[model samples]
Target: MSSAKLSRRRVVGAGLGALSSAVAGVSAGCTARSGPPRRLLLATGPEGGPYNAFGAALARAVAASGSRLRIVPVSTAASVDNLRELDAGAVDLALAMADVAEDAALGREPFTRRAAATALARVYVNYTHLLVPADGPVRSLRDLAGRPVAAGAAGSGVQVVAGRVLREAGLGEGPSPARERQLGLAESARALREGAVDALFWSGGVPTPALSTLSREVPLRFLPLDGYVGPLRERYGPVYTAVTLPSGAYGLAEPVGTLGVANYLLARGEVPEAAARELLTVVFDRWSDLLREVTAGARLEPRFAISTGRVPLHPGAVAYYRSVYG
Candidate 1:
């Protein structure tokens, strides 16, 4: 309760202490003194996705800590949408792809304006999945140029990453234009099965439930992305990593070299450092529990978590890390 941000929304979860709060002006901005934050909203990805699952589990862990702070997990389009939520003051914290945060901070293409956000910490690396049917003609990302492809839901981090990968692959303005469909994770899988899309791009943790289910129902294969990693990293900063998607993931037979992007936890830059610190404390303390429930959280290492690229780390997050690591 010592470091919880208060908002008008429903509580995200209870904090460690059963403290209460009294904000001088919640709508204008919270100025609470000596009480648990009434509520907090955490912006996460779509339902049934890794982001949402992990967010829900995090809410549960915070509530179980007995802090009396109520944290509500919000499911959205993910990344870009989460940043928007934070900008609109609809959420207290959010999970975002580092590249998206970098773009948002810079007010680059896609984002019309700069957002008042800063990195709480780096979290995980989402492996980019360029999947096609095992028996289909779309053997690689280049092969799907003329075909209908579900790049990702409109404005989602998935689509953003996909667009970058396509550009780096020299398919940005190729002759055979890809009919990119705006589809969510589940919808993309169903559309692929229904012959609506020849290939689909996804950016998430390994063993994403929807992909696993899609693999079981249909013979699907992921195109290797390692070839573009070097170029992507060179162009898009160090956020892009060349990593091999382990074999047996989503039932693949052997490892496939692919590009991975770092994911981040962010909060409004206006949020008090102490509140940010509390959020970090809860996360670090209960991180193991989150990992046990969803291995996607296993990447929440202190060292990597602090590697927030272009997005500067929050002061509170900095303090928390020093207290623990030092």
Candidate 2:
């Protein structure tokens, strides 16, 4: 911590006392061992994605906070790939799904190596949206029992959550015999428009750019998944929560209630404490302005961001949480 600047005390004894105090104060101000400013890499997702916008906002906020930290926006898939970047030292910070972060940190599923990363905080929930044709009858997960569904690409977090949701609804293990297609978000949107697929699963923030762009031309229907909330919460630990996407978020008819998982900010265990403190401070202090930059990032709050599941919080983040919120 930097020492507070002190004014010279009243000189009662001799002129020597006042001179000594002034010299000491000046020396303290000049020689205080402040840590060097750092440049950090912030790994987000593809262009027009929530992570991309949020990352840019964070960068601006940090710069405005008088912190000598730079947030370099790196494009990533934000699933297992983000964890790999942190492990390989290609990036210092990343926006990652809580469940995926947990698995990688614990060396569970996709992550063969237990990632040396820690959570900064949970930012917001990524609600799963099952988008279908507006005129279709697929109002719920069960309605797609035999229809063509485009699950997201393999190795993506969207696919992981979609698979889990399907399993919880007793539709996994290929039991439903539905026509399933594996494709990316863009491909799925095209497939849905072409009638090649009846439904598509997209797990992202409300008003996702891709979904919004699709809504501009196609009449998209958001399928609700409330029935699986209880079962999903019970099975997936506390990561799954009931969330609602407001009406008109994507020019929809009404709000869509569904289950979702929180997204978290993560960093390698070796990030400097001072750097973390300043970075988090920037995020919280300039939150409102940052939200203006990334419309969806308005959900970021210091109180809500700290909601980590089982993953351990980084020591630096812990200090910030204590100093400001304890």
**Best candidate, lDDT:** 1
Residue 89 of model 2, lDDT score? 73
Q: Write the per-residue lDDT of candidate 2 for residues 58-148, one digit (tens) a residue.
A: 7655554555565656655556667777777767888888878888877877777688788898876788888888887877677778778
Candidate topping TM-score: 1
lDDT of each prediction vs. the true structure? 0.76, 0.72
Q: Candidate 2: how many backbone clashes?
A: 0
**After superposition, which runs of candidate 1 have C-alpha atoms over 4 Å from their true positions?**
1-34, 292-297
* Model 2 score (lDDT): 0.72
Q: Give the per-residue lDDT digits (tens) of candidate 1, residues 1-326.
A: 01123333323232221212212222223233346455777787776777777676676655565544555677677888888878778788888988899888878777888887889888777889888989988877888777888888875899998888877766767676777788998899999999988988998877677788888999988899998888877777888888887888888889999988888889887777777777777788877766553344354779888999878888888888998897
Question: Model 1: how far is 243 from its true place, Å?
Answer: 1.3
As a whole number from 0 to 100, the lDDT of residue 212 in candidate 1 is 81
